[model samples]
Target: MTDEAIRTERLSKHFGRTVALEGLDLEVPRGEIFGFLGPNGAGKSTTIRLLLNLIRPTSGRAWIMGVPVGDVRAAHRHLGYVPGDVALWPQLTGMEILTYLGRLSGRVDTAYRDELIERLRLDPSLRARSYSKGNRQKVALVAAFMTRPDLLLLDEPTAGLDPLMEAEFQALTREAARRGQTVFLSSHILAEVEDVCERVGILRDGRLIEVATLADLRGLNATVYDATLDGPAPDLSDVPGVASVEPLPDGVRVTLTGPPGPLLERLAGTGLVKLRSHEPSLEEVFMTYYESPARPETGLTARLDR
Candidate 1:
């Protein structure tokens, strides 16, 4: 089998007049957690459905574990998916639904399934229709995780979950990756994905805009630092890396464009009292793409590690 968990070549999808995803060429290597990021209507959900072969692509093709996605049964055996919006059999209990799905996957590790259910705090005795959104999400997550397939495709899986459950979900991803399962995390919550994913692919208006490692994403935008001073505030305006310095009531907020070494050296003797540094969120790093499509030359992608 190929080392690639997923490979898409010019994958395009259309629905009548609307082009959902366009000419996307991407590869997700084995044992890597890849994040697919885009805002709603940016074709994030459409792309997930296409990978699951729930809908045929208008053009191009996709492969899962070196098996063409067109061969749904074979490809699906190696994939576990949680859609952005989850649905379950209304007449069945959560336990029944999971049991049915486990059977369908043809590899039901009953002990692991029960462990996930308990860890997620799911009351599976409740009928599917009676479960709240968060409970339903828990059920779906359990179903996906229990199988422990080769590839896990989670599209906005944390929605409807509380902070506690969200934390659990993140932990589960780490566990999955540790077991050598490749995770394809698709979400608009940039920070959530950035916390666990090694690589990220940003999609905008049906196109792949940028792909970068987490470290590269850190430098793709300027860093913001806030400092409180006991002594006279040093003039950071001329510092080599300082982009802009704005005065705050208590102190000044400095925006550093590149290396922080120059700024740190300048502040050494300034008698700093309290200082806080903030890294730009992935969204903030690529706001240009989300904000405007007309301006195509963002030039920020040049810094990404290819």
Candidate 2:
């Protein structure tokens, strides 16, 4: 009913001296697919647990579809979640596990469930004990998706899935968005996130470092242009928006930040033989924040804005 599928205010969690999550303030709009990205031990799972009310936060609060997380039954009623690692009763078949979970959720569209099973290529007849990790992941995905809840909280949802299955997962995510479902996807797979997510939040060391659209993030970083020339390279160090220009054996590698117009204008008369431009991949942008020593409260996006 609420416009926001999820909202958190300075949410934090700690394990004794260890801070699992700290001062996290985030809001996910209804029908949006939001990506939560961070490396291991970055408190991604901790944040999800707090949202699910599986663990209490040390400070602050969160709400799921207008219900406070403290009210577990009401909050959970609007969402379905799949953990990073799945475990099923070894004696039960995949179908049984799905049926039990469906009952626990208080809702299930059997037709949709069957469709998901088929699309994911899951054999529900197999015993859980005999299923490989990928198969187990498939089962969990089906269980979470079948209900068509207001929000789907997935942490590493594609961990053991092969490329083909990963593609299917992306398709499912798109379909969910088309049906106006919000998906909170926590993953380290940059390519998958880039392919499916409209916006992403990057976390580091239990802190939310950045949150923005992928295009915005890419715009903030430098773009590399490798140009091969028939003549000597021109001096482009003083050009505006030019971060650096390194001379190559044949030409020069120009690192431009804002726009290509200025750089292109400068290289127009320099006998441009061949030119190739490289946009920073999402992985590169992620690494810039991940590998940075400074943990600025405002994040790189803020600094880049100035």
Candidate 3:
């Protein structure tokens, strides 16, 4: 089997003059938790549908585990998917829905399905029509996880989930990665992506903007430090990582771009009474790219950057 679980070759799709996706070349290696991020109408859902072979691309090709998406029946058998907008048989109970899907899948582990249902706090006895949006989402999540497929495609999987359930979902994602499942998670929730994804692809206006590992993105984020010192603040204006400095009533507020070692060493030169630092959230990091003109990800120079 190939090391890559998913690969796209200049994949594109269009409707009339409306381009849903354009020239998207991507590769998702097996056993990695990869996040797909974008704003609304950014073609994220369109990409998911193409990869699942539910919608044919206007141009380009995609492969899953070396098998082309053209043979969707064969390619999809090894994968489980959760759509952003889940539609179920209104009259069927959650249990019935799972059972029907399980029978179709031909290999669902019943015990695992029940465990997932319990973990997601879903009441399977209730009919789909009676379930709330979050509950319906939970049902889809349970169905996806229960199959324990080799690859999982999740789009906005946590949209209707509450904070507590969102945390549980993160735990589930980690467990899935540990089980060697390749997960392609598409979400607008930056914090969830930061928590679960090893690497991420950001899309904009049907085009891939960039791809970066969490570590690579962290380098672009700036950290802020508020200090209360006994004496005058040390001279850090010339420090390599120091971005800016502000004199306050108590001490200095410093913003750092890269490593903290230089800043720390500089601060040590003076008497340090107290110090606190706040790291930028992943949302803040994402904004840097979203707001700025496109810069190729320094690390993904060959693919995403180009």
Give the winner by TM-score.
2
Per-residue lDDT of 4-86 in model 1, one digit per residue for the tens?
99999999998999999999999999888999987677778888888988899999999999999989989999998987678
lDDT of 3: 0.85
Backbone clashes under 3 angstroms, per model: 0, 0, 0
| Alpha-carbon runs more than 4 Å astray in model 1 | 225-278, 288-295, 298-306
Candidate 2 lDDT score at position 124: 98
The stretch of ten residues in a row with the least summed lDDT in candidate 2 is 297-306
Candidate 2 — what's its lDDT? Answer: 0.87
| TM-score of each candidate structure, all chains considered together | 0.81, 0.83, 0.80
Which runs of model 2 end up more than 4 angstroms from their true locations? 227-275, 291-306
Error of 3 at 171 (Å): 1.3
Question: Residue by residue across 110-200, what tens digits does model 2's lDDT show?
Answer: 9999999999999999999999999999999999999999899999999899999999999999999999999999988888899999999
RMSD of each: 5.5, 5.0, 5.9
Residue 162 alpha-carbon offset, candidate 3, angstroms = 1.3
